[model samples]
Target: MKTLILFVALVGYTQALSYSDVLEEEWNRFQLDYTKFYQTEDEALLRRLIFVDNKRRIDKHNRRFMAGKESYEMGVNQFTDLLPKEFQSQMLSSLNITEAEGLIDFRYTAPRDVDPPSSIDWRARGAVTPVMDQGENCGSCWAFATTGTLEGQTFLKTGRLVSLSEQNLIDCSNDAPYYNEGCKGGLELNALMYIMHKGIDTESSYPYRGTQQKCRFNSSNIGASVEAFIGVSGEANLAAATAFHGPVSVRVDSEGMQSYKGGVYNNPNCSDEILDHAMVVVGYGNDKSGGDYWLVKNSWGTTWGENGYIRMSRNRNNQCGIATIAVFPIV
Candidate 1:
């Protein structure tokens, strides 16, 4: 009987060690997979991986990346609450949680029905800029989109043109909690709100690093200040286009964006699901096709679209709340 008991103990110890080994192996694989996935242009698998419910699998991957750091411990509790309950358990069982919260939220809103600025010159509009591609494993899109729009608008306003740093908004912006970190998804209006409330520092003051870091406080504010905010009901009104002179923040669908490669995108077959991504409308007019399109500045990078912007069809009643919240920058 003693011999049998000893044998059982040995087996249990081996089982425990095997479990540990499996986790270590999986952790290594997770890192390699993540790097390869991000570096390559192939997004078919990535789109599947990101949109699917794989909280536990992702938690393990995050743990491996954040191993041996103080942030890891903090991530343990934070990630638990952030992941769905089922995923939390699966991740905790195999790996230590390091980074818990996702940056993007599907729900948020801007102030409603404000008028757009009228100073915008539709004739002066330039070619669509390149698409700004936000690499995977990062969530600085809000800052990028905000800065991208600001850059175009500034170019239209001054004609000198300057590339505003999205990284500034990612790191700085004290108006909203999510703005503090680019890891969490944020809205363009939030950046505008910060600019209006606190004033913005120049791109030279705050450069775009493409990653999250500590914020540098500026003593002098530079961007236009907003006096009031209003909500509009539909997209057909000329008021929506007028708001472009100021910051007109709008939300649109961005799910299949990973595959977007430039075109007059107006596919009725595509899903109508709208993403929380925001952009600034620099100008609007009837395209050569006579279809009304809003000249939108994007943050993906200059390599993607018409330079770095897209011409989305407007007048669908602001289908996804694109015309809902328009803010005029107090000139």
Candidate 2:
């Protein structure tokens, strides 16, 4: 009987150690420090903490990629295990869309060149386009998108690049007339409206905390303002916005964006009118393969595609809603 009890104890210990080994492997595969999740060395608890569902999703992702079911590349990413589907929705479509917001029009202009530049990357053109930002666990992507466009406009107007504060909008816009959802989510139009009424402060003054907090805006410390913001809903308008102004904020259906590691993402399941995730169109460009693509700046940080950028397939009937819900702030 004692020998049997000792054998059971040994088996239990081996099982616990196995769980810890798998957990540690997954943690390292995700490139995340387990210390960030928890400092405790309780292997059993850590095994339960790891997202098993993501393991399932990762398996499916790899299967589809291997079978040529995905148009884009897939890899173990920062968000691979940390985010769930509901979290993805919160990250993308936190804004309540309204007709009033969509009907706003622009006095559109045609591209000066009969053939627009084959490649235009504002990042290389010396704009105060801020470095790629990480929204982290917060649903503050709307604020990041707003601040990105504001920075572009600020650069165009002052010839100086300034990294503006998304936190200022997240913390303060709740009381503003724009009906901001605060950190939960917000619309670019409402953000622009908030900026028009009350100018936004700089990142230095009110840095991003990646979560909602109390309003602490000092009107006296305003960093940027827009002369006006116009909304457009087509490929021609997006082209005009990029050529006439700088980067423009737009939304597209981010159905399969979570696993998007690299490549010209062309998802058939993506929605064109159901605008969800907000990003910026810095310019339109072509790849070396002669394929046309839109140069977009994402707020998912430098670790994401093309170093915080995504080259989206362009002129494909506004593929992924790239043409729909396009708006820009003019400084």
User: If scored against the real structure, what TM-score would every candidate get?
Assistant: 0.54, 0.81
Tens digits of per-residue lDDT, candidate 2, 161-210, equal: 88888889888888636777765677878888888888999888888887
Q: What is the lDDT of residue 319 in candidate 2?
A: 86
lDDT score for candidate 1 against the true structure? 0.48
lDDT of each: 0.48, 0.73
Number of clashing pairs, model 2?
A: 1
Weakest 10 consecutive residues, lDDT, candidate 2? 30-39
Q: Supply candidate 2's per-residue lDDT for 44.
A: 36
Among these predicted structures, which one has the highest lDDT? 2
